[model samples]
Each structure stands twice: as structure tokens, then as C-alpha cells.
Target chain A: MSSADFGALKHPFVLRALEPSDYRKGYLKLLEQLTKVGEISEEEFTARVEETRHLGDLHHAVVIEDVERLAIVASATLLVELKFIRKCGKAGHIEDVVVDSTVRGQHLGQRIVDHLTELAKQLGCYKVILDCTEANVPFYEKCGFGLKERQMARYFS
Target chain B: MSSADFGALKHPFVLRALEPSDYRKGYLKLLEQLTKVGEISEEEFTARVEETRHLGDLHHAVVIEDVERLAIVASATLLVELKFIRKCGKAGHIEDVVVDSTVRGQHLGQRIVDHLTELAKQLGCYKVILDCTEANVPFYEKCGFGLKERQMARYFS
Candidate 1:
């Protein structure tokens, strides 16, 4: 019922579907951290937080909260896209899995992934894929994600 | 100078900044791909695309298009977040570098990344980070990404 209730569970952590209202809090947390460290101009940070809340709504975004802490410790989303490989197939691309640094070592990360993987399967994804930095390869591999042979790009100007 | 002009280059790939006007086209592309292949329901796909496009805008999305094809070959964004190390730094989290499958193996993918990397540098990002499956390790490495550490996570439901 409460954010702390969610985090205090004994088993690894439980996942929850994020509601529209959660965005403001999550964005503010991110903004607070950014501002405390002076990584963004206050103007830029405010604008980004507002914009990100809108985007989070669009992604069917979900969060893994530390129920005890009443904080969103980790989050991930399935970016479902259609593909015509040989024949049409549904693809689920997982993106944006962020875990709070304070809770990094408690196996909470693996729990969050397990939850997302199940969601992907239920969605009937022919393939559930995610990208991670080189450092994170072993973790995903441990989660059962194999290497995909594709080049990725982004156009930011 | 114009979206049409961007659509006119020989090989004519144009990398444009994401705007509110472009959200519809971007969302449509994501929905059509995911829905046609059955990754998500029409309703879910539409909703998710809208959220992602909005997020993309907040992060300063960019798109690469093949003018003649009138198709988005690739897209990516830079999420400006603060790092929490002793020497906290501003970092760029690169997200969703997707290139249409039909155009895979062309250097378009690399070009898109190059553009964004430059942008990250200009934006004063100490480092630009992205994630990919093990399969993409070599490709990203070839593009100059060094191995960091493995990231792991679990989903709780």
C-alpha cells in the first residue's frame, strides 16, 4: 500500500506497475541528485524532468521500488516493436533499467530483471532484447540475454 | 533547411532534432513495427509510442532518415544524468539507437553514432554510455566503447 511496504519484503523485491502519478516523484529524485551535484543547469533540469514525466507515461514504464525505503530503486520497460524477419514477429526491446546506487548490492537488480523477463514472455515476445554497456554484459547474460548481431545508432544533434 | 530537404539528399540521410511535430511520425513508426509483428496491442503500442516520443524529446531525440525511402533508418537520444562518484560528473546516457532492418549492414548505423558522440562531447558529457547485448560488444568496441563492468537486475512482480 505504501512505498516502504513494497521495499521491506523479504524475498528479493517485488515489481509494481508504475502509475501516472509516480513520475513526478521519480523525476524530482533524479533532479535532486542532479542538482545536488550540480550536473545540470536548474533550468535544464526542470525542463528535462517535466519532459521525462510525459515520456515515462508513454513507455508503459514500470518500477521496482524498495518498499522499505519507499523509493523506486530500479526501473525498466519493454519497448515493443513489430518486425518482419522471414515473417512478422513481435519484438520486445527492454530499455532504461536504472537501480538506485544505495541499493546496488542486495540482489535487487536481479529481481527486477526477473520481473521484466516474465512480463516480456507474457506479452508473447518472440524475442526479448536489451542493450547494456560492456560492463553490464555478464549481468544480462546471467539473466539469459544472448548477444545480438546488430549495430545500433542514435542521431543527436 | 526543410524536412523535405532532409528527405531529398542523395543517399540523402538527414539527421534532425526531434520536435513536437515529429512525434506523430516517430510514434507511428514504432507502433506499426510493434503492432504489425504483434509485439503489442494497438492500444498498448499507441500509448507506449506516445510516451517514448515524449521522453525522446526531453532527452533531445535525433532521427536519421533516408530521404528517398522517407523512412527513419535510425534514432537515438542523449539522457543527461548526474553521476554520483566522488567526482560527480555529467554523463550522457544514450538510448534507443534503432535502425530499420532493411538498411542494416550499411554504415548508416555508425554514422548515427558518430553524430551523437560528437554531440555528447559538445554537451560536456564526461562520458557517453549505452547498453547492448553481448552480440553487440564487438561492434560497440569497434566504435571505441571500452568494457565497463557487468550490470545485472531482476524484476519483481
Candidate 2:
């Protein structure tokens, strides 16, 4: 649905691909609403945006924008992976899913995840997957995601 | 190290970036040695290679080559992910880490992992991560990787 087509939205909002200008200021503002994020300089933000853009159609930065103030209210990323496996030989990873607390009950998160999942299928991903916190498990389940493996990670910092 | 730097070899082998020519015949041979994979037509193989190559430096396909047979015998992929996090602002994913069973225990797996880990650092990734089964955890730990998060997934078919 278009950002302006937010008839169900108490406020006007649209879901769309993140624009270049949105990264530095607008994105950080909406992102920090979900979690505490370290400050990123505008130059770094611009460079990183360009880098992700260069990742081609396999990567998508999707966000919901409030039309009135033109502010982002939610966001998620879809990363398609190439694999040497059966069928489609590709996989999709959904990450950084978040909705502004102010807009939580609107089911915006569900819509965003659903949108990305469809996009992954269109991209010929054999499967769509994600890792979420233990508390977020039920949320993903509600969005039609099934838990299969325990999420694991390693941080060098 | 250059592919030709096989001077330390007890057997004839080289490590190198996967060339487009390796996609169809050589890659499949090595991949099958790792696990059972479905057949991939030459057309599909070529198309996928071109698509992945278009992904630029964000993804790396590293392989071990059998000098005598002129074929890939072991392989790993390094994917760089842009993140809105601290430190380097990016993460690295190591996938498809496999060594040919015929050449098992030659330390080729360790060398390949080490190579990709270094590539991640150079790519400005704050951390390098992968998901492995319990049996393989010690192998990765031996290669200087430590367990951090419990792995999780939602596979669609």
C-alpha cells in the first residue's frame, strides 16, 4: 500500500525503499527508537548506503514513512544469498526488523515482514529465514515464521 | 596469498578466488564431495556466476584447487553485511565451508577459514560469524573462532 494510502493508519504513512538522503538523519532517528545505536557520521552513512545499494536487487532496505512529517516509522532489510544447493540456489535473510513503539499495535511490523517475504520468493529464494531474540519468537511466529534452529552469533568487538 | 603459492604443499594444491570457468564443472565436483547437491545445468551455472560476480566485492568465493586435476577441491564464501551497529559498522558471514573428503585433514579447511577471516577484517567488518553444528564447533574453535550465539533459522521448504 502506498504511504499515503494509510486509510487504516491513524496517520498517513507509506512503505517504500529507503532513499539515499534518508540514511544519515531520518534513518538514525527512526532506528534509535528501536534500540540504542552508535552515532554514524554523515559521510560514513552516505558511503555505507552506496555500498548497500551496489549490492543490487538481492538486497532491499524497506521502510515505512509517515507522510505528514515525512518521518520513518518502521524498517527491515532483506538480504538474498547465493548458495550451492538444490532448487533455486538462493536464500533470503530478514534482519533489522523494527517498528516505532508509537506505531507498534498498527501491525506495521507484520506488513513489513510479509512484504519482504514475498519479495524473497519473487527473487527465487528457496527459503526465507530470520533470527530473532527469544522474546521475539512469538512475534515472528505470528507473522508466519517458524522457529527451526537456535540463533547463534560471534562478535569480534 | 597467490594461488601459485603452493610451495608449502605436501600434495599439489592451490588456493585462489573462483574464476568464472570454475562454475559449471569444477565447482560442482568439489561441492558434491562436501554434500549431496542437485544437478545444475551449465546455463544456470553460468547465469548464477554472472549474477554473483555482479555483486562486486561484497561477496567472495574462495576455493582450493587440485593442481593435478585442475578442479576445485574445497570452498568457502565470505559475505559482507552492512549493519547499523558499533565498531566497524559491518559484519561478515562465512558460509559453505567445506573440504573435499578425499583431501580431508590436510588443514585446507583451516587455511580457507583463516583466509576468509582476514578478508573480513580488511572489508571493515567488526566481526566474522558462521553457524555450525555441534560437531563442527571445535573445528572452528581450532581455527580461532569461538562460539557466541545459539544459531536459529526459519526455513521455508
Candidate 3:
């Protein structure tokens, strides 16, 4: 959905696509709460944003911005993979979902996930999946997702 | 790895990118071994292949073709997602991994997955992940992936 499509997002909060200007809005800073996000310059962030923009609907780096504070309070990305199964169906992989620590109780995580789920449905996705820790399963279950399988990973050194 | 970079495969078998002509090689039929594949016309398959082709390294749909049988015996896709984490790093999501039932015992699944893992590393991904059934846990563990988390999903009707 477009920024306009999200309607009024609790007054000062607006959900929208990651903009070039979000570099100054603590976008990367917010991500540090999730994982190891090292030093990222504005040029690097802008280049990546342009690359994602070129991908159109296939790459959505969505964010909830606090207009009053001029900071990114929550973020998530939905990467749609078109498949040969289910007659060329699409699958959505929700990644890097995080809500800033200070804004935890407002249900922004659910809101962002719900919005992206809607977007995935609109994009003709047959299923939307995500990998989360056991502690986060209850949160995701509350957001309409069910525990399906185990996630396996290999982290580079 | 490129088709050339994959070194040599077993006799009459070659690993490479999905081709436009693979529609005739039963690509969708091979995918059927994994999940439901509805009636997919050649036009639709070609369209999707072209779209994936345009994405270059971001979408790696590697396949193992049996020249003698003139069929695709195995298939998997590695989708590299550029992330804001790990200093603007990339992560690989391996999906729809399936080996033709007829070709299961030859270690084709491991070969395909290991190749993709190497490609992910070459692409500078900080990690590679996949969701699998409990029954398949040992297989992915054999491929050097450790059980990381639970996978959650929402399937659209």
C-alpha cells in the first residue's frame, strides 16, 4: 500500500516506504536493536534504497515513521519470491521485523506485519512466512501466523 | 557459481541457471514433487523466467538437468535479500528446494544446496537460511545448517 493508503496512523505516526531521507531518521539506528548493523553511510543507504526501488513490489522495506520525532520507530521488509509451484504463485518472506524499544506496547509490530500481510495478499502471494525465535512465536501467532516448521541457518564468520 | 563455475557434474547431468526452454524440460513437473502446481501454461512459465532473469544474481533458480532423459531432475532457488543489518549485508533465503523422486539417492539435494550456500557466501551474505519440516532437519544439518528458530506462516485460501 502507498503511504496515502495507510490512512491516518495514530496521529503523528505514518507508515510508508523507506525514503532516501530516512537515512537521517535513524533507520539504521532502529535496525541495530534487531541485529549487527555496522557503520552505514548515507551514500550506501541511498544506493541500497535505489536498488530496492528498482525492484518495485518485489522488495518492500516498509517503515513506521514518527513525524513528530523525525525518527523511524518500526521497520519490516516483505520480499516476494515468485514460484513455479501452485501455478507460478508468489511467496512472501517477512524479514527483519523490529519495533523500537521505547514504542513496544503500542502494537506497532502487529500493525506493520498485518499491513504487509495485506500487501502480500494483494500481490497474489499464496503464503507469507517468517522465521522467529520461540519467544516471538506468541507475538506472531497473535498476528495471524501459525508455527509451521523449524528454521535452519548457517551464519558466516 | 556460474554454470561454468560449478565444475563438472556426474555424467549427463549439468547444473545451471533456469533457461527459457526449461519449460519443455518439465520444470514445473519437477516442482510438483514438492507441492501443488496448478495448470501453468508455457507463456506463464516463460514470463516468470524472464522476470527472474532480470533480477540477475538476486534470484538464483539453479537446476540439475539430465541430458539423457531430457528432464529437470532437481531444482532450488536462492533469493538474496539485501538488508540494513550487518552493515547493509545480504542474506540468502533458500526456497522450494526439491529433488525429483527418481533422483533422490544420488545426493543431488545436498549438491544443489551446498552449491547455493557457496554462492550465497560469494554474494557476501552474512547468513543463509531455510525453513524445513522436522523430517528434513537432518538433511539440512548435513548441508551445514543448524536449527535456528521456528518458522511461522499464514496460508491464504
Best by TM-score: 3
Clashing pairs in 3: none
Which CAPRI category fits model 3? Answer: high
**Predicted model with the maximum DockQ:** 3
Fnat for model 3 comes to 0.98
Q: Candidate 3's residue-wise lDDT over A22-122, tens digit each?
A: 99999989998998899989999999999888888898999999999999999999998978888889999999999999999999999999989988988
lDDT of 3 by residue, B1-157 (tens): 3442675789788888889899999998888889899998899989999898888889999899999998999999999998888888999999989999988899999999998999998888899999999999999999999999999999999
TM-score of each: 0.47, 0.83, 0.96
Residue by residue across A114-148, what tens digits does model 1's lDDT show?
Answer: 66576665655566666566777777888877654
> Which ranges of candidate 1 are over 4 A from the true structure?
A1-157, B1-11, B19-58, B153-157
Compute DockQ for each candidate against the true complex.
0.12, 0.40, 0.91
Enumerate clash totals for all models, in the order shown.
38, 12, 0
Between candidates 2 and 3, the one scoring higher on TM-score is 3
Global Cα RMSD, each model: 8.5, 3.8, 1.5
For candidate 2, write residues B45-149 as lDDT tens digits: 777767767776677887888878876788998887787656217778888888888788889998898888877877777778787777787888887887654
Q: After superposition, how far is residue A25 of candidate 1 from its true place, in Å?
A: 22
Candidate 1's DockQ is 0.12
> Can you give the lDDT of residue A70 in candidate 1?
63
